[model samples]
Target: MYVYLSKIVPLFLMPLGLIIFAAVLVLLLLVTGRRRLAAWLLSFTVLLLWLAAMPIVAGSLYGRLESRFPPEPLARIPVSSCIVVLGGAVGLPFAPRQDIELTEAVDRVYKAVQLYREGKANRVFVAAGNQPRSESGPSEAALIGELLVEWGVPADAIQLEGRSRNTRENAVNIKPMLEATGCDRSLLVTSAAHMQRALASFKEVGLYAYPVSTDVRAIRRTEYTAMDFLPDAHALAMTSDAIREWMGQKVYQWNGWN
Candidate 1:
């Protein structure tokens, strides 16, 4: 439910949605002709306000979620029964061998497999559930699990959490599967920028999992120029992800998840 609401809210909050509202307001002003200038100004103001709230500006307005889960030496943590991998981003929807492709979130799946093989966890959990808006038809966890099998990891070694529709549900739904597999605690894998919310959601359910973040967002580009300011849709997408995660974190805290 949380995931569904979050995905839908953005359609009404972002620049595109606001642009439509602006156009309607502008049309209203032109039709009324009584306060044309004032109406135009109001419409433009609303558009500008929505743009300002875009995630591209502040990378979620809470800075990057990196510091919250710093890199820990693998040796520092104890091995567990399973390593949980949360899925979000998916590769091209219609690729012939789509399961093999990797996206920002898929990097966590690969990392989870590596951790499992390295003795960090005896089993791997792929939490690939997604909301209805997901363009990729397959549950992310299932796809990654297939990829893992293709990469030589036995199907028996993986636990796919495909029913969860959001982070909160990911935690809630995975509990029974983990219990069935005798996995009390496991490493939680996800993009570094999303670790804060993911961990909090799981923690809220009384499931303590170690953070193992991948798909870091910070760019170390030496050249910072006009392109940074220009609107790149991909950048906007990443920004939205960061912002959504931050919003999720706030929601979790408010719900006493922390």
Candidate 2:
């Protein structure tokens, strides 16, 4: 239930949806001859919303939230039951090409494989659940598992937790397996940008999962420049992800996950 709610909150909070309502309101206000008031208020509101999303305006906010946890050291190996990699890639069967492929989230699997190869963890658990809307339509875990196999991590060394639909559910569902296997702790593999929320969610469920973050997005820099302020879809997506993780952290805290 909580996992489903996490997916919905972002749609409403991001203002992508609310912008339509605000635009209609602005037009109605203008049509009624309150042009001056509408113009002033609308301009102010739009400016504020844009500013809220502007990377410069929100960079520090994202930085603070992202910095709550540092990236795990690549050289340091931790003891664990298994390295748990969270799912982000979805199988796309609707495309003209039919072969399975890696999506952006596949980095999570790659990092897990690297760790396993380095002997950081003896076993790997891919937590990929079903995305009903997907095309190839298998649980993300299955897709990642195949990738791991191709990468030469033997099939017997990998466990699939394909029942989880989201991070919260991933944590909820993986707990019993962890206990049953007599594993006390494990390294959690995910994007560096999303490690904070993932760790918090798992810990909330009483799992002591250490974070091994991959796919880092933010870089620390003292020099500010014009390009940093420019709006780019790729940058906006990263910023949005940062904000979503921060918001998820707050929600998890409210649920006593922290």
Candidate 3:
């Protein structure tokens, strides 16, 4: 239920959603002979959209979330009992594509494989499952497990907790398995922007996880070009992602899962 709500509610609260809502309201007001109020609302909505699409504003907003957890250097990564790799790094296989499609967060899979090869963790625990309760395709964890085996990690060394649909479910479902395997401490691999909430969720479930942040989106320098001030679609998307994470954190806290 929480997963469904998170997916639906955010569409009405994010920048683009709010702009669309305002535009529709403005149209309604204008049709009702409320030109003065409609004009003001339309102007405000346009200005808000412009600001949200600027690279400088979006970068700063995303930076704050990504910077909450720094990536652990490969050489300095601590050894742990297991490596827990969360899902959302791959797209489910669809028609015309027989293989699992990797997404921006594929770094999570690569980092987990690297840790296993480096002997940082004796086993890899993949926490993911199919959505819509699919019965025909492999779960995300199963595909990741296959990838690990192809990369030379023994099949026996990989564990699949393929029943979780979200971060909180991942923590709740994986904790018991980890405990059963005597793996109280594990390296948690996920995107840098999502690390804080993921960590908090695991901690709330009484699991001790060392963060191995991947797919960092924060800029390191203060340098900016003229184009940075201009409106961009990519910038707007990044801002939306940041806003979603912020809302996710708040929701997780409220649910006592973080």
Candidate 3 ranges beyond 4 A from true positions: 133-136
Give the top-scoring candidate (lDDT).
3
The TM-score of candidate 2 is 0.87
C-alpha lDDT of candidate 3 relative to the true structure: 0.90
TM-score of each: 0.79, 0.87, 0.95
lDDT of 2 by residue, 1-258 (tens): 555566776876664545556778788999999998888878876765575566675566656665766566678757667788898864644567586767776777888888888888788887878754552467778878888998879999988898887677788888887787776788898877677778878888889988887765566878988877765555555556666776777877787766
Tell me how candidate 1 scores on lDDT: 0.71
Ordering by lDDT: 3, 2, 1
Which candidate has the highest TM-score of all? Answer: 3
RMSD from true fold, candidate 2:
2.5
Per-candidate Cα lDDT values, in order, are 0.71, 0.75, 0.90
Task: Please list the Cα RMSD from the true structure of every candidate, rounded to 1 decimal place.
Answer: 3.7, 2.5, 1.5
For candidate 3, write residues 1-258 as lDDT tens digits: 766788889989999999999999999999999999999999999999999999999989999988878886788988899999999888878778888898888888998989998999999999988776453578889888887788788999999988888899999999989999999889999999999999999999899999999998757766888899899998999999999999999999998888
Q: Give the TM-score of candidate 1.
A: 0.79
Residue 164 accuracy (lDDT) in model 1:
79
Using TM-score as the measure, what is the rank order of every candidate, best first?
3, 2, 1
lDDT, model 2, position 21: 64
lDDT value, residue 256 of candidate 2: 77
**Tens digit of per-residue lDDT, candidate 1, span 88-174:** 746535556634457656677677767877788778888877567664576777777887787667898987878777777888898
